[model samples]
Target: MSILVRGMHGLGDNLHQRAVIRQLMARDEVFLESSWVAPYHDLVAAGLKILRKATPLRTQSKNADREASLFHRGPLPPRAQEVRITYTPDLVRARGSVLAAMCWATATDYAAADFRMAVPAEWLQQAKLLFNAWQPRKPVLVYRPLVDRTEWGGCRNRNPDHGAYAALFDAIRDDFFVVSIADLVPGQEWIVSRQIRADVELHKGELDFETLAGLFKLSAGVFASPGFAVILAQAVGTPVACVFGGYENSSSFAGGARFSPTLGIDPINPCQCFSHSHACQKSIDIPAASARLRAFFAEAARHWPGCA
Candidate 1:
């Protein structure tokens, strides 16, 4: 029997899933499936031997420890040993206990896959579609707007602040649209209201990886976050002016970005990100970030020979 491991959560979780699958597949024929996992359904579809657990009539199940097993009753392409591992300590050695062994077994260990770095082929295709659908004459501007849980001193979250980096587009609003992936509330949509000068796209569920890739292909430059999208954008062959959020994960994640004022890198007074309350999100200085971003764009234009 082949194995089907679940728990494909956010970028980090997906990495765990992939890592575990890689380990299992090395020994026996294992199939990695993540349909029961939200946000990663498309990814699972793009891969082979992955059966969806969504359609009850479409899945296939066998008599196994029902509690320990997670099976798809759908069209079973070819059955593999099935198991489920979450983003729990038991799976990844969270506590540094002999735990990783106690839980997964110490006999022969399989290193987990680094999900953030693993871009599914489907997402690349999605990016291609986005570029093709939105045909623009002017160079594109791709951005990742910061979303904070709360506001604090100099921690502006509105359009004026977020668009501080807008100077990169050469004042061509029709040519560029910034992308925001932060889950925005109806009331919070206006945070980036000022980007009206430039076409700004807030990518909720509507825009997938293909759309993002398309945008990257069409862009003159990117204003990236310290997040997953930024990593993807850079990898898609786009010149990016990125800014880190608050920690080492901020810099190391997207191949490194200029740290934001909210990250103690800003020259502004009292450095909002330096506060003890973890106000970095709120303290990100829009103007400071924007200035650096604009410079990066200009440099890209001057040097990014094929990218323009």
Candidate 2:
């Protein structure tokens, strides 16, 4: 049987689908989206076909938008069975992880799935060279700027006070070599400037996708808002100290959806506010968060030899 797995909504969603895709590749021929091809260099080399679709024009009309969506999503072979993956909170809680939830969606065995990302040998080598150049004397800690979703109904519920991150980074400065990572839009460096100053900056173009995943594998851990960075770290077997705000806890993304049980980090929201509204105005406790992150990294270092 031939399978056409539709592309997911975001980078993290696409990463979660990797295990499911691998399961399909073992049983049948599989085709994936062009946008989804970059992160899975290994899978592509292993025989995953890139789905080709006609490009659509940019337009504001509803009918034109619908047509564009169809153009990118359709023209499937009549004999090929298409699989559309969907997400729900209930399914995620039941399966214990988003990867498991997706596995269940595609009739794949959840226990047998492997979520670790495999990059090319060259990428790993390049990452090691980059790490050595830094001469990092302490355990490396990744610091990503706080960025909220900008499209498809933006959610600010998980956004904490930008100043909180600065304090956290400052507390860990002497013990950790911080590497700030973000792809800021032109004239938008304030997104990171407000977060914290780091020993090194890896903005856009500093490294490619696979190489960055390789760097994550070598790091002690990462501090990020709930998003793709957390998923990327988990995929590469790196510990992540997810800095969550009051509106939403790790249950939605970090701890619940994409939690790696072996990592041993409970990225829960520790704030006084729990309003479901997107405009939630609760402040996160940075001092407490910093303490937990320090402890989390200490534990990770005990097990992960890469921390040295």
Candidate 3:
């Protein structure tokens, strides 16, 4: 019997869910049915077929029953089984294993293996062309600056201040070609560095998932806020240095400890207003964070001979 997996909402959530789906694919014929298919088309091309004929559903609904019903929509072929899996901070904390929690929810057996993401060969070629066009002189470090708005699940408070990001960019530009991958909103351009430097480049426009995966694969390391990019970098075997405001615990996420050696701020005493509002009173030591990040890169450089 073939299995159908319900999709999660955000890019990061969907990426994390792949750990479970990959295992299911190993045991049974599996297909993903979700409205969020565009971000993961690279996987589809790599052999994970998606149910495109299924009716698209909104990410959330007012009625809880309706929300669950979306997964049941569209016709399934004979002998197709549906599986539902949910990953949350509570589940991660309780299970002490992100992969296990994802597998437990879907009733799949977990295997100890590295998380895998498919970067299409074409996309890798495109990334090579793009990087060559930029003519970077030093090792490139990719980054994503958090937007100032609070649209995606009250995450605005987790975004570092523009000044703090500016300090970080300034600190690292001498040794690494720093690139910001965030698609900034109009009038919100100041969230990243404005200084004219040869080593700094702001990637304008929206980049598709394949291109992003390719970029991550080519980078020396990634420095990003808590978001999809961090997970993407990890999936491509690139080390990450995460910058957080005060909301998330560093250990709560799957790759936070394994891939990220340094965090921008301490998560031990999180601000009371975390994950709810943007009025955070916690202070981030930008200079110290920058030094730690440099140290991380130095360690990574030893393994990546070209980066040295």
Give the candidate number with the greatest TM-score: 2
Clashing pairs in 2: none
Task: Compare candidates 2 and 3 on lDDT and give the better one.
Answer: 2
lDDT of 2: 0.64
| lDDT tens digits by residue: candidate 2, 1-308 | 87888756566777777878888899888877634455666787777776633233111122223333322343555688887766565676676556667877878887777656865677778778878889987788778877543443333555655666566656666677888887644543325327466899876636656678778888877777766778888787777766565544565443323334222222333432334465544455666767776777777666666633
lDDT of the candidates, in the order given: 0.41, 0.64, 0.61
Q: Write the per-residue lDDT of candidate 3 for residues 1-308, one digit (tens) a residue.
A: 68877766556767777767777777777778554554455555555656533332222221123224323344556868888777665666666545556766777665553355667788888778778877777778886755554345544566655566557656665777777775545543324334435454555545655677787777787877767777777676777776666555444355434543444444335443335554664456766777877778877655553421
Against the true structure, what is each candidate's TM-score?
Answer: 0.50, 0.77, 0.76
Ordered by lDDT, highest first, the candidates read 2, 3, 1
Top lDDT: which candidate number? 2
Cα lDDT of model 1 by residue, 116-207, tens digit = 22344665466655555655444556655554323222223211224333442333233344444444445432244234343546644355
In model 2, where do residues sit more than 4 Å from their true spots? 52-78, 93-96, 187-193, 253-277, 285-287, 302-308
